[model samples]
Structures are given as C-alpha cells and as structure tokens.
Target: MIDLLKEWIINIASLVLFITAVEMLLPDNSLKKYSKFVLGLILMTVLINPIIKIFNRNFNISVYSQNISRSIYDEDTAKSIEKYKEESLKNTINNFENNLTQIIGEKLKEEFNLSNNKLEVKAEYVTQESKFEIKYIKVGINSGKVQKVEKVKVNIGEKNIEEKDKLHDDIKSYLSKELKVQEKIITIYKL
Candidate 1:
C-alpha cells in the first residue's frame, strides 16, 4: 500500500508539473485564466483518482447514495412539508385579502352612503408571475328594498383607467401606499 501510494503521488506531481510548464509556455490572453483553472481541475482529478480506486471494490456507491438521499428527504415527509407550505401560504393570503376587502367595504359604505350590513365584500385574484396575485377588488352593494334606488337602472361598468380619473387615482395611490405595490398593478370595481 505504501509503494502504491508513493507511485500515485509521483504520477500526480509529474502531471501537475507538465500542466504548469504548458500553461507558462502559452501566451497571456482572456482565455489564459480559464485554461489555468481547467488545468487545476485536471490535477485535482488525478490526485483523487487513486483514492477513488482504493475504495472501488470495497463499497457499493449506488446503495450508499440511495441511503444518503433517503435520509435527506423521506418521501412522506417531503410530501407533508410541501402540503404544509401550500396551506400556510394560502391561509395567509386569504386572511390578508379578507381584511383588505373588509376595509374596502367600510370605505364603500362611506363613499356611497350605504348602510353597514348591506355591502358584500369580495376580491378577484389575477395571475402574475406566480399562480395567484391580487388584481381587482369587487364591492357588491346590495341595498335591499331601498325606496327609489333599488328600482334605478344599473349598467355594466368598464374598468379602464386614465390619468385624469380622480377616483382611480385616489384608490391607486391609496393601494400603492398601503400595499407597497405600484398603482399600475391594481384595479378596483363596484358591483
């Protein structure tokens, strides 16, 4: 074993010396550093080659890798962790949106002079880079059996916003401040 190790060490030293000589002979350029790095990697592989050979027949690499992987991530535990993450994310976003809609409902009550109990608050989520993102807020005003207003005609409303629109500007500024997002990403609606 000592003779084998000594021979391996000699071989590695010779290879490194040869690589160094070759690199010194080459012209300095943008690729010189990269070439040196590759040569270093080659020397490392040569140094480790014999050590790997020493263990070649003694251990089963496939089984060892399987056991290590299992220890790192058990199937059931991985599944459960993924599920927990999804649920927690969903719950947190839902609670935030619920609170947001409630606030909007109060604001709507103030804006439209509606009673507290009649506004149905809901939110619509639009897809961003991820699966779901808050895009539009819908506040349903259900003034049940109000004298003349219930009979008034209602029309479908468009949500296009211009820079001159004060309500959109106000709401956009408010949301941008409160939610810490750009106004361009949010839209509000009343139904």
Candidate 2:
C-alpha cells in the first residue's frame, strides 16, 4: 500500500510537469485556446481514470459506453411509444366523431324522407373524475343532390334555404329534448 501511494504521487507529479512543459511549448494562438481546453479535459480523465479503476474493479469503458447507449435507447423507445399512443388516441376520437355524424345523418334522412344529407356535429365535452360529459352539441346539416327521381332534396338554393330553415323547428325540438342539449347549439339548413 505504501509503494502504491508513492507510485501514485510520482505519476501525478510527472503528469503535471508534462502538462506545464507542453503549455510552455505551445504558441498562444486560436488553436492553443481550443487545444488547451481539450488538453485539460483529457488530463482530468487520465488523472481520475486509474483511480476509478483501482477503487472500482468492475469499471470498464465498454460497460460504461454500453450503459449510456442503453439509457439513450430506452428514452427514445419511451418517446416513440408516447407519440404512437397520442396518434392512436387522436385517430380513435376522429373515427368516433365521424361515425356519430353518419348516424345522425341517417336518422335525419329516415325521419325527414330525404335521400342525401350532410351532417356536421360539434360538441364540447369535459372529463371529470375519469368520466366524460358533454357540455353542448352543435349540429349543421345540408341536403345533397342525387340525379334520380327516388333521390329528393329538401332545399337546394339560397331562396329555399331560408324557407327550409324555418321548417326544422320540429327537428330541433326533438333533438333538444332527446339529447338534453341546448337549442342554440343545433342548426339545420337545407342547402
């Protein structure tokens, strides 16, 4: 142990002297500015590396690098998984909304005897205690034209839109009562 201590002291002293000699030989230039910082970092690594290895028998460069790479990989994997989950959730919500709109369109067509209709439904919802509740739902509907006698349109132009809009009071009344939503959120147009 005594010999080891002496050897360590001698090694450190020689390293310090060598660094000083190198610094004296190098010109004070832009290159030296960058090189000195690099040199100092290398010196610190050299100074501590042997000490670390001596105290920690299990320490190795390959193991340290592998651990660093593994941690980075884990972080990247976690990030990708989160991204995928977010994308899937967004797609699911979009699909649900689209399907809801389709169902609403079908029900309206069946009741009103319309052949084709476009229905857009918007809703404001909130989650409380992991339970979802809708605050308000807005509905916008338009009639489409199909070139057949069986396919009939409610109102096709601006002139008919104004006339047809007033005729949807029964529909609005039904939706307001059935869905338990506000009357202001429901809009039906025949255009």
Global lDDT scores for all candidate models? 0.65, 0.66
Q: Candidate 2: where is the Cα deviation over 4 Å?
A: 1-73, 123-166
Instruction: For residue 134, give model 1's deviation from the true position in Å.
Output: 1.5
- How much is the lDDT of residue 28 in candidate 2? 88
Per-model TM against the reference: 0.38, 0.43
lDDT of 1 by residue, 75-175 (tens): 88899999998797778778767787677666556764544433232334443644445555533334445445335454559445333456546765765
**Segments in model 1 whose C-alpha atoms lie over 4 Å from true places:** 1-69, 106-132, 142-145, 149-191
Position 118, candidate 1: lDDT: 31
- Model 1: lDDT equals 0.65
Model 2, position 112, has a per-residue lDDT of 67
Clashing residue pairs in candidate 1 are none
lDDT of 2 by residue, 62-124 (tens): 788798989888978999999997796667666766766776666667776654555666433
